[model samples]
Target chain A: MKIENIKKEFPIFNNKVQNNDLVYLDSANSSQKPLVVVDRIYDFYTKEFSNVGRSVHYLAVAATNLYENTRSAVQKYINAKHKNEIVFTKGATEAINLVANTFGQKYLKEGDEILLTELEHHSNYVPWHYLRKNKGIKINFAEIDEHGDISLEDIEKQITNRTKIIAITHLSNVTGAILPIKEITELAHSKGIPVLVDGCQSAPHMKMNMQDLDCDFYAISCHKMYGPTGLGVLYAKKKWLDDLPPYQGGGGMINEVKKDDISFGELPNKFEAGTMATAQVIAFNESINFLNKIGVENLVKHENDLLNYGEELLRKNNSVKLIGNPRKKGAVLSFTIDGIHPHDIATILDEDGVAIRAGHHCCQILHDKLGLTASARASLGVYNSKDDLDKLNESINNCKKIFNK
Target chain B: MNLKELYQEIILDHGKNPRNLGKFDNFNKDAKGHNPLCGDKVHLFLKLDENKKVNDISFEGEGCAISMASASIMTDLMKGKSEKDAKEIIEKFLDMIKEKDDIDTKLLEEDEKTKLMSLGGVKNYPMRVKCATLSWHALSSALEDFQKEVTTE
Candidate 1:
């Protein structure tokens, strides 16, 4: 694929933001949808819409197949062993909550600890906190190093006999630190602790194989994958799917509904209760196709190039101070400018049609550790290039000039 | 909508070197305000005398230029004003940022009104309206003696 012309695949890039070409560098928050994904959504809603897995009608059966096709596509993409391991949820936040609720009910007890890292987004940490509040479980944090990276030793240091499970982010959203999931999972398994990898950041930028990582559970955000919003994929080991109770009680999740007793359905359906985002699930097949066309390896190289260029440019600017210097980083450039707040930087950047995210980026614990209330982040996606970084650098200079720094 | 108007010289000056900063030792009424969306925080301290007039007002917080300047300018104008006058001014300022195009000129002096109106540019940026008004709301909560922390969700 011609990576330079990839922005043409997204309709959003065709228009101007504030009379200037949109320099969208906020993909760490949510990626812009490609033309293929958007078209799939429209096509499904207009010509081939139906409630899936409900009726034996031709449209219903076809819709059901399309929905399940996404499951198999996700299974194949992530290399999960079983197709049934992929369960759909509202988003990654709901996916993590499902595990915390079901696993907390089945496994956790009073005084049990759920070890998380300081780099986790609220989606990874807040769900476990619910268990801490209700189940009397303790939550321990694996501290980040000076470079904002969490090592295997950091996870090992927090583990105890009472540690029930270890949940960590595959990539830090704030510091862009990529965790060694395969190694961390191996160490957790040695101590009989299950590891849950929050792959919201990693899934869009790297190659993921369930067997290679060996993590018990992985949560994916579809919106960040150039897929439709209101859809997420939860990849769990089938053993846990069978052992844990259903997350929600509603239609399509139960094998037989009875007044006194009920039997839940099998595998993914048991966890996916009620009517799902049928159109989103169907459209997400296009997202997988989009990623497959370019290939994740190509995407990684392109984004890494942008990251390196943006990092070098920002580092050369004396007023700009980057948050972390992790040895292994992703496509995120988070920084603070001297004599300027992040909000001001964001406003000034937006004036030049440079769209970046400001504030803690939903990683408050990490921000607290960095001793900053907020910082500005310019994260990249497949469509971004060095030109966008140049715009960002120019905007930073404008912000510094405005503040007389 | 214009960046130049939104970030005027006065706003930047106050943001860089905020006036009436730091907690007051004799503060009697105080309240902390938080903008959970952006993580901006303001702790306002007020010392109302026996006549219910603001003898001294100060604040300490971390926020964007708009917020810090808003708080700094607010504290500068609030000193020596009656509690009733402080509440009225806060209401007017918030009204201007939220919906009203201009703040009532009678509420403040010409220089003070211009400083407060400098923040009026925030009205165009809907996402940042909270940044400009977070401290003013904190002052309102302090005057009312609200026990809970004020939040701009």
Candidate 2:
């Protein structure tokens, strides 16, 4: 696809805010929705809209098909062994919580460890904190290298004989470094520990084949892949799904509701208890199509080029201090100017119609380890280009001039 | 850019070379406030006068320039004000940040509140509201401890 045509897909790209183009650099936070994904949702509500998995009426049947079709699409996208292995969730945050509660607490015990990396987001961190309250589970953190990449050497140190689970992010949202998940999973499996891979940053930019990766669990959000919000995907292994009990219980997830004894339904249905987001799921399927059309591999190469260019540009400027320098990572480049604060840096960039994130970026532990107060981050997406980065470079130089840094 | 253009000349002068950025040699009252969101912290030291006014105010912290500057300005603002007036300024500062022009019309003109209320522009960015208010919150809590001590006697 031509860059211009890809840019045209998003309606927000055309928004004339402050009499300039809105250069969105916060894709790591959430991707901008394309028109097709938006319209599919609009059309679903306009035509075949109804509560799914409920009534056998025309609209309900169509709604059910749309909703179930999404499961089949996600099943193929991740190459899951079965569609039942794919559970719809609110977002990666909620999906991680469900597993930490249902899978972690149920299986883990007192003095048992939940090993994680220092590079992890707080969503993965705080859930284990809850276990300390209820289950007396111990939390252990793996060290991050100076470049902010997690190594097996650090991970190995934290994993004791008593370690039951290892939860990790596939891509560091801060440094954009990709972890060796297959190797990590193999080590975890050798110890008879289940691994949960947070694929929030990886899934949108790269191809995922869970069958090959063989992680026990993988979680992603639809909105991160240019889909609508309020929906996520949790890809669990077939064996794990068969043994683990349901996370939530209500209507639709049960096979038989009796006065005394109620029977639970099959694999995926047991996870989805309430009414599902039929239209949103269908729209989410369209996001998979959106990725498929451009091809995730091609998208990866294009983004890597941007990352290389961005790194080269920042490397020359002595005033800017780059945090992480992982050769293999996503396009999120976090840096801090010598004298200017991240807040002032972000606001100055915003005034020039270039959006960037400031502050600790929900990774306080990483900041503490880096000895940084806070750093500004500019992340790339499929729609980003060299010109967008040029704007960032120009604005950053302007920060030097304005603040005399 | 002239610092006075954005901040009051008084604020700029104080922020450039803060009154007491160093460690307090003979510190008495002390408290700490941490903004976990941005990983910014403010440790305050006070030597209260016999009349309970702030005789010496010093701060130490790791924060963004806005937070550091705000704390610097705040310590300067508290030099001679009574404890009651200082607390009122802190209250009015938060009110002004969260609800700018919508504030009670009469209170905007009040001298003590208006000094820091000039910083209400930081309210536009909701994420940054905490950055601007971190120092004020620390001062509020530190004074909380001071008040507690005064009543305890």
Model number with the top lDDT:
1
Reference-based TM-score of each model: 0.96, 0.91
Q: What is the DockQ of each candidate?
A: 0.64, 0.37
Local error of candidate 2 at A150, Å?
2.2
Q: By DockQ thresholds, what CAPRI class is model 2?
A: acceptable
lDDT of every predicted structure (CA atoms): 0.90, 0.81
- The residue-level lDDT of candidate 2 at A40 comes to 96
The regions of model 2 sitting more than 4 angstroms off are B1-15, B23-30, B102-118, B146-153
For model 1, residues A1-405, the per-residue Cα lDDT tens digits are 689999999999999987989999999999999999999989998988999999999999999999999999999999999999999999999999999999999999999999999999999999999998998999999999999999889889989999989999998998899999999999899889999999999999999899889999999999999999999989999999999999999999999877899999988889988999999999999999999999889998998888988889998999799988887999888999876888888998998999999988889888999988889999999999888899899988887788878
Per residue, candidate 1 scores C-alpha lDDT tens digits across B1-153 of 376656857555775678999986988999999998677899999999999999999999987888888888899999889988888898888888888877884868888887777788778787699988899889999999998999877
Q: How well is each residue in A21-79 modelled by candidate 2, as lDDT tens digits?
A: 98889898899999999999999989878998889899888888888998999999889
